[model samples]
Target: MPELAEPIVIVSDVHLSARSNWASKLDRIRGLWQKAGTVVFNGDTLNLGLANRKEMCRQAIECIGQICQADGVRAVVLAGNADSILDGPRHLLLKGGRLLVLHGDVLFDSISPWRRSAKKLRAARDESLRKMPPRMRASIEGQQASVTEAIRIVHDRSGKRIRSRRRTFLENLVSLSWPRQILSILRAWRDAPGLAVNFMETYSPQANCLVMGHIHRSGIWHIGDRSVISTEGFEGPRKPGVAYVEGDSVTLRIARQTGASYQPGKVIGRVAL
Candidate 1:
């Protein structure tokens, strides 16, 4: 047998549900394994809780676990919002030599529950937005501000992210502390030196690649001599791949998704992503 190359493949946000079409995607995932010595299953592998829906989430999780543990290699996973209680708190994921894997939520301590996503971000969430008095909303939009920033200010000022969506929309309209409150928030903060590497900041105190998952965007950055990298979510029709590189190689490549690579049975595309 040919010697398998040691590769670190980072993958995240595979919100696999029972209904999701994932089997076909797994075929391409095979491309990662023959070369991978380490696999990073970043998080959100499950859809989460509902009396009626928990089963689907469970199946998704089981399927993901199976995929991660395959190929007789070790895999690391992080927690994600959709997995909620199962999102396994900080420190669940660790890689060698200054590589840190975290879900990126527990960093701030208080997290808006996963259930709140729809009510908060939905396009028709106007009643929730109406209370903001227009100008502050403009600021958030202006800075391309993170929703975490908006919610943090409201959370700190009134001790709530907003007042039941109905009343929260306007509470900030009258608060004098809005500006200061937004300034003070510790957005995406981590107490651990290794875990602190962000796409924008240095990866580790010693400085190496910092790999994280949570927002589900694929990215790479230079951290001193280190590289901070992330692979986008595999769920929701994203163009996803598990990347592999070897022997301190400078070149990295992403394989194309099988489904979109070809139309009606041509040939699956393979391109850098």
Candidate 2:
């Protein structure tokens, strides 16, 4: 695969939609495009998982694409648990395969294990994997395929669950973050780094740095020889982290909102790939 442009900026879990503050976020991301040669939306750019929001998701994607075209910035959108319908690449290998970027949902068998539907999601994932040939199941592409299928299976039925309530987006978010769900989220955050390291060791042994965003925790951990980097989320409680990749190095920085745009803030971590 060819290399992305120099000074690539990667952000994930932006969750752009008509129901959220997507317009302002888009302005910030537009600023991001102006500062970098290429911008990668690591995953969950929009919540296509919600059947009711499919139209909104489509509009959000189109708007992003249009802006990218107008700005002349190369944009890459990877599929996430929420946006599994996207046909883009699920993972990227950078710096001669030493740096891996993915959405991070594939790190766990249950995907978003904190969700109320986690059991059903895991069952769907397991059934999909079981049907795959053993050789294919061992490959990264096959794993992504099964994950996409599982997401589809669960999310298709999720329409009924979501439509039963006519709550605002904030209310929906609050519902997902209830007390029990908070505990589950905390558990996932604690376990994610180790699972990420094991994932790279099993699938991409050449990669020493794994950059991902799903659990919405922006931090970096050094696990023996490997580094697990979570870029955080736009819709979460914490600020987001933007990963800048240039040459053989990757730097993690906090994103600070300045006026209508977001700029790279303090450097929290760095890794040599």
Candidate 3:
């Protein structure tokens, strides 16, 4: 029998928030956990910024550590928006060479969903007070709004703040119709530094693979001989979870449980790039 080499695996967006769907995928993670050459948390392992479920977030981090240590694979830990709540390293573990590990939220507008939600709710409440009975509205106005433009305005301000941090966020926004706040999300696989003026539209010509574990939209963008891939997640009922690849001959496989991990959880199955 031919000697079997360790398989390369990738995972990300393990949003351990109470609302996330990592239960089913984490149970199965042990199966793939035992085989890979490397395991990446890709970030957002905890709902660190969330208002509730501290215990759940803690469990998620512990579980990730357990899987990495048990498997004997080098674990790459990066920060997601959730992870940013604690304020430590932004990202860790790069690829083979000098590629830095990225949490992707650095490219984001805001790393704290809890904060963002709170502010929006506050703005909404204030706006609603403007319309309701002053007596009853006084209390509710302190919480959220009932109007549309108030929320929109608050969100718009958030985008401007996001652009201040990451140039990539602003640059990428030029391509989409999505809200500007999305631009602030720290990104995993940026446009490879100086590859192109348009990072999202650019691709590597000499690299084997450009790996990224954010966006949750799993698919590979190939340009010439280069390939860019977005890692799936364990947050929702999506396709093959987060993934990783090492070569061109390798093909990306979407597993039975690879949809929404939130940041970058490894619930994905990998064959080739």
Candidate 4:
């Protein structure tokens, strides 16, 4: 693939669904696109896997396409756990292989350990890997395929839940923050950076910086020679973040609210290639 444009901005887990604030923030999102020569929605731009939300996802994608049509702007979408069915690449190597950008779900066997279907998804992933050719099993393609399979299983298991148009506070709280789920979330957070380093060591050893979003906790962690940067989810307890990629440097910034929309705010971390 060609080199990404300079001043590339990445945001993930926008989760543009029926209940999201996207409708009012469309202009703000467009403003973001206009600021950077290239804008990458790193993952979970929408829940395209749901049968009930297909039209909503389609509209969101169309809006994105329209924005990208403007002069000097480019948009790239990398598939996440929620939208793996979309035809988007799961990962990208940038800055001549010194920086890697992906949705980050492929780094775990369960894809999303905090989800209620964690064990089933983990088992599905293992089964998927076992079915692959032995040599390809360790490749990036293999990992991505397994993650996609796990997401497919999640869709199958949550079809009814997804189809429901309304959600109460208790329902949402239980699904997002039950005791078991909280423990799983903490474990995943603790393990993500190391997993990122191990993944680079296996496939792209030269890449010293990894940029991803999933698990929702955004921050930078330096482990040995590699730096793992996660751009937090759009809707979360902690503030969301965006990462800017420029010549030989990557900077992480919080998504600060400006009137009705969010834009890159304070710099949290910077990595030089």
The clash numbers for all candidates, in the given order, read 4, 0, 39, 0
User: Can you tell me which runs of candidate 4 are displaced by over 4 Å?
Assistant: 19-23, 48-56, 157-177
The regions of model 1 sitting more than 4 angstroms off are 1-5, 21-28, 49-56, 67-70, 87-96, 106-204, 223-226, 235-238, 241-252, 259-273
Tell me each candidate's TM-score.
0.50, 0.89, 0.49, 0.88
How big is the positional error of residue 122 in model 4, measured in Å on the Cα after superposition?
A: 0.4
For each of the candidates, the C-alpha root-mean-square deviation to the true structure, in angstroms, is 12.5, 3.6, 15.3, 3.5
Mind sharing the TM-score for model 4? 0.88
Instruction: Report the C-alpha lDDT of model 3 over 1-273, residue by residue, as the tens digit.
Output: 121133545566766666655545565654555656766566666654441345655666666666666767655555554454333444432333222334443322222222435456455535655667765443212212232334345555765787778658677767463453355232323332223112223222223444555556565665654445565565555664545434423334564433422233333333233
Error of 4 at 201 (Å): 0.9
Q: What is the lDDT of residue 232 in candidate 1?
A: 55
Ranking by TM-score: 2, 4, 1, 3
Error of 4 at 91 (Å): 0.9
34-106: candidate 2 lDDT, tens digit per residue: 7577888998887764313666666777777777777777788898988888877999988878899999999
TM-score of 1: 0.50
The global C-alpha lDDT for each of the candidates, from Candidate 1 onward, is 0.44, 0.83, 0.47, 0.82
Candidate 2's clash total is 0
- Residue 230 shift from truth in candidate 4, angstroms: 0.7
Winning model by TM-score: 2
- Over 79-123, each residue of candidate 4 has an lDDT whose tens digit, in order, gives 898888777698888988899999988888888888877778889
